[model samples]
Target: MTSRNRSTRVSILSALIGATLAVPAAFAGQVDTAGIQSDGSYARLVVKYRDSARLRTAAADRVAETIAGAAARAGIAGGVARGGAALPLSASRLRATASQADVVRLSRALDANQTQALLRQIAADPSVEFVQVDRRLTHTRLPDVRPMLVPNDNYYQQYQWHLHDAIGGIGAESAWETSTGEGVVVAVLDTGITAHPDMDANMLEGYDFITDAFVSRRDSDERVPGAADLGDWNPVANECYAGSPVTDSSWHGTHTAGTVAELTDNATGMAGVAHDAKVLPVRVLGRCGGYTSDIADAIVWASGGEVDGVPTNASPAEVINMSLGGGGACDTLTQDAINGAVSRGTVVVVAAGNQGQDAANHSPASCANVINVGATGITGIKAYYSNYGNLVDLSAPGGGVTDGNPDGYVWQAINSGATVPEDPTYGGMAGTSMAAPHVAGIVALIQSAVEVPKTPAEIEAILKESARAFASAPSQPMGAGIVDAPAALALALDGGGEEPCEPGEPGCEEEPPIDSTPITSGQVVTGLSGVAGTEGLYRIEVPAGMRNLNVLTYGGTGDVSVYVSRGSEPGADEHDWASTRPGTNETVRVANPEAGVYYVKVVGESLYARVNLQARYN
Candidate 1:
């Protein structure tokens, strides 16, 4: 594929306007306060009202009255205040969330504590469904100095080890021979993008979803066309937050976009994972960080959903990469967006955050129906700053700059600008933010490699089933393993299983029966046996709200280990929970297991027979 000039392509973005957004199903409970700060700093609230004729067509005044009513009922007092000045808590309808909930917003920024209290009040109202603070999420990159070798790309051999290095790479070089992600579109939702000659040819028209004029750095609050990198440089002290570090523009989106779809074999820059694919650069982040509301809209629009004011996407993305996140569980707004995208067949991949904590506490990363990615160093160990835990679905090379390996950073195209757009150059950055695009690009490769596009579920299964085991044991659970592009593509192309051999092919034989046997709760299976280095895979469908899930193996002669994981197959070393006793008897229990398909792998440490396995949850 040849590169094309941007000036010659028709723009796909148009004027952004306010409209009702589609929301997800009713999430009953106290509003999500996971990311809400209690520091008393100023912030706004995202409120979703029960669908009523009044709310669907309510005016701004009516919405305000609803807020007042909720506050009064909660026994709160006093008007909202900002900067020590009394301000009217105005309301504005954004759009219906995917749940069909009427999403409204409080315009006046109130004290964080006050806002949280108000959110609870709003959530308690009979007419209100859910409410939460529209927390800001930043790009998850850790700054580092940045080359690579491969496919005649100048930097591939020197700097892009994350693509082909057997120890840590995604096997992209070999996968490229099978698929270059041709005809696939990957939407990059981040700080927009910069003009880089190396990636310019593969760029698609994208939109800016930022609504705040202050954050968008525009004169008007209205969303505009074109998702250009406007430089989110924090020029003033504490502009983002009190004592927030002053830093230059990250050009984060450009780097990620380059990783996803930069032109390959151009003989000038580093190779991209899916160079034949196109990038739809949706700008959601800006100065300081972007709001959850804006990012959610980007997710919806990029996946070909309707967003009020923005034109329908000319080229809906098959994969969406969000290398941004912040503290919090999955918020309703973001989850609804992701749910819609997944239902539309878009594979959503997100960063596991750079907080070095459980990703379960992070929004988007913790969101269901999305592939959560953690970062790995050059040695294929979990990055020290990458978030971990059960929610992380997989790990990828995100570089280990802070781990003292300067050359281990993921390198890609970036701008030389400090405050605005500058000359295009290459650099390295570390974090799970860098890890996500690698997976996203692999998704594109798999999507393009097969004759039929795999569903989001199928894609996820292929990635996990084909992933290479981590080179070393991680300090924390880093997911199934590192994504292997060639393996994944091959799996997809082989009809999601072993490719059928030709009748006359040499060494061809009948395939063995699949080992995936369904096990129900409180059921015990007898006569389970396996030889050393062999394993039996079983699954249990744990319905929602299952507590005390217990899987026990006993009455067996051999030494067997039990490995359990949710939603995907588990390996001896990669599972959510494990029990390896000296004998065949082993037990793994969970206090409150999330409702999903739990996979159990019974591996034989030594050869023996006559085993009984029981999985029961109350």
Candidate 2:
């Protein structure tokens, strides 16, 4: 394989796959509707009231009335001024959010400026906790192109190269021999999953949480049971926003769920990564895009949390696959929901976006406690449209047919209808949306393979340690490496196999014992150097009451990695936090670290010189 010129390869690719592939660098003849404006364009607000006995015990109607009064006092009653014209501000009532009763969703006709002003005024009320715009999120899928040369024979062994290909696959076939993800549940939160013979059996009863009538295309603004695809087809261009194009309903949830748990060994169509795992389809996205508030509620509900009006999830998922994303920092509502899910032992996996830019600019992808997955092609190189940055945790096969690799798209089950449900068939699609589920399925495999379930942090550490090296150095940083399913399963079964010395254990020297170097807080060491096979160790004493522990290595040159652990020796495979970006720049942050002696290890992936290392806490 040869490398292509990155500067010249930014163009729309429309061969092999009939649909025009939207490359991140360019979109020709069509607008990439997936790109959303992060600021001042929203028409809704999410307000969370402060937690108090009075607020908690108040009636839902009473709470709604209080929120309404606050909004009215904020000068949000009349028409909103935009572009020298006043837009009608509908008399909207506040509705309690399903996930948390204290939180409410307010919809009205307002431009960006009025929304911001209203939010500020509402937040000033003593009864209010926090308020922000209800941002919109869209599925991360690029177009799926039906391959012309698909054989009439078994597609699993022939076309599903991403599952078993040694260079680009997740080694799902090998891992299947040990674990088929039995008894594990995974939640796919995208456009609702449709009825497909290939994946129907594995799907549990789901709910449609889209509350807006226009977005849901339903009779009224109400969240109903049963997660079904209502066809997010846009008949008219610009219906979603200014310049948004007309498009067909992408059965996105069904495609992603098929990749996660579609039936295998049935002598049938395709093989899913975790063929035996149960899928809990959660519908949050719809026409245009779903509101961030709705997606947040689904996250909490799918993880066995209590939603105000929804039934309890009898079978809460052990893992969540969010193949959807949008721009901006993670909102407070979404973060709170994710925090709740992680605390309940659910591992969240999200797409690194298809922007071909820094992933830090995207939400959920940049959110904490999530496994941010980037896309890799059959050649084991980063996909051209995949978002790349230090925040990306790993890479998986999301296909790259448009990047001069004509046959690298991921094949899976899809609907045949252009605007609604039809016959079940197979097709090839590409994007970080596809990449995320591969990792999510692998996580299920790991969970099933182990005798005991691991914590989110432990599972993450295992994945990073077991990832496969890229075929060659990538042009940009794409996480630790491509995810290796077999390696990750083996690591988990072996209990992560690290024998770090714990604090208060005998033979654990308090001082720097000859082999290690001692460093102090707020200290910076420069001119550090190492070879490919060499290792550098440093230790620091963290006191109590410090809010954060930060160990960073940057400046100078060469490829270096930083690993940190509390009260134990850190290494490549044994550390609480690991930062292994491509270059010398690396950072490991530990929140509310315990008071103890922490170990830091710096290892070179290649020959290195003149590196700087620092340790600080506050």
Candidate 3:
């Protein structure tokens, strides 16, 4: 893929599936305009006005009064957070959309299709800038993946193939050398993270944004601090509806959060991409998935915006990762929230989706300025279940089932029990849901390495500019090729200054073929492993009579070994041995050689390359 930008439109999809985030679970098949918990005829609307001035002054009340009057005239009776006509439950339907603004999100049971007419009334009002109704979102899990697999305390070498994937992994190994994502915060708007032993060190106090009492498993209808995953399990007995069925809890947020900032090199569980990054678990999803209103509020609050009724967020996140999405055009509410976040310098990353269809139809991912991530299999091709289309910003190891091996799925922390949140354990689950966090983790890493810290736009530029080219282009366009951590980090560590390149421009710095291309001494070059049996050859012009020489290889996964040979192509007979036990890193050192020229051959035990190679002569 080239660096040339491709056609893009602002859009978003729904979230929640596979224990991931978003999508009110019970609504997976319920597309009617009913509120997530209401019997029917319930809709949430986001209304904004043209006059930004009147919003912050005494006129704010006047603008709101005008809106309330218009709604009443249009047969709408709900007040802010339900302060309108009757039923305290109305409070659940009304709330200020933003602080110091007439922008308001109001919910009410309108006559069938009457919500659009109400929006039209609101839009016709002289003070209104725009209006949008919330759409229904649902979550669905697919068949499990299978793979042949490892165990590491800080390493989980075999299981975390996605981190070290030679072709599609995010390239975490080398990235850690430059930045461990020490100071950045990633706010995960999902079911909230579990209290996993592997993630406690990097976890921060968060909030519960699920406002629906039934969906939140709460006795009251209020949101609270301390976001915790109580398991989004729907009982077959049907309290949510007449026929809502029971399903297994995905513990999806646990998996997503674990991937983003799970404790790394801690001698337990699996390694997170951004080891030192802190995760702010925002509970936007629960029992049946989550309400769009709650999700939208979380997005705004995470980026440091004020959502009335919720406490002011003191720990605003630099990066926001939403793995859940729904199908539809970008809603004004969600879009506005994302816009506000990006404007505030927060990098938002979302999954393209697992529907295996064009991603143009998904929210959040379709939304503007978001990094929509698609899933790649162990083979580096698009994952079978991943959604595609021009909307995707990039691809990452979402993990795919290979030969019925479950290990093909990206593995992370999960609950031990089936229906309830329980003991911490680990498992592999596949979806575009599993792919978004990889890039979010890297965003934290990039934020950590830069001096002044990059704006979301600049961070995205570095990510696209330094990404490795795909071994094989996906059937449909995937964003700027797969994400390459080490390469991206190197550019970031150099105080990145690359602009956002046009998508799919060939022969650019981002898509160079370096594995087989030889380079001179000391300069670091980026390259990929491609397929099995392919090797990168590097020639270093050794100065005559050099006392010592060292060849080192770090980053990528699989078993890649390095061999150095002088006076001939490096092979079994002429090379000095420097094999180190059985790990991903390789190095070969030579002493006191009469130097002419030396060649380094990188051999993969199982088709790996995407490595950072360096040769030093003294």
Give the poorly placed runs of model 1, Cα more than 4 Å off. Answer: 1-30, 40-42, 52-57, 72-108, 143-153, 401-406, 497-580, 588-618
Q: At residue 329, what lDDT does model 2 achieve?
A: 61
Candidate 2 backbone clash number? 1
Candidate 2, residue 223: CA error in Å?
A: 2.6
lDDT of 3 at 31: 22
The number of residue pairs in model 1 that clash at the backbone is 25
Displacement of the residue 597 alpha carbon in candidate 1, Å: 12
lDDT of 1: 0.78
Question: What TM-score does model 1 achieve against the real structure?
Answer: 0.80
lDDT of 2 at 390: 68
Estimate, for each residue in 155-205, the C-alpha lDDT of model 1 and write its tens digit. Answer: 777778888888888888899999999999999999998888899989987
Best by lDDT: 1
Question: What global local distance difference test value does model 2 have?
Answer: 0.77
lDDT of 3: 0.69
* Candidate number with greatest TM-score: 1
Predictions in order: lDDT: 0.78, 0.77, 0.69
Q: Please provide, for model 2 over 290-362, each residue's C-alpha lDDT reduced to its tens digit, 9 standing for 90 to 100.
A: 9888899999999988887788999999999999988866666777788899999999999999989988778
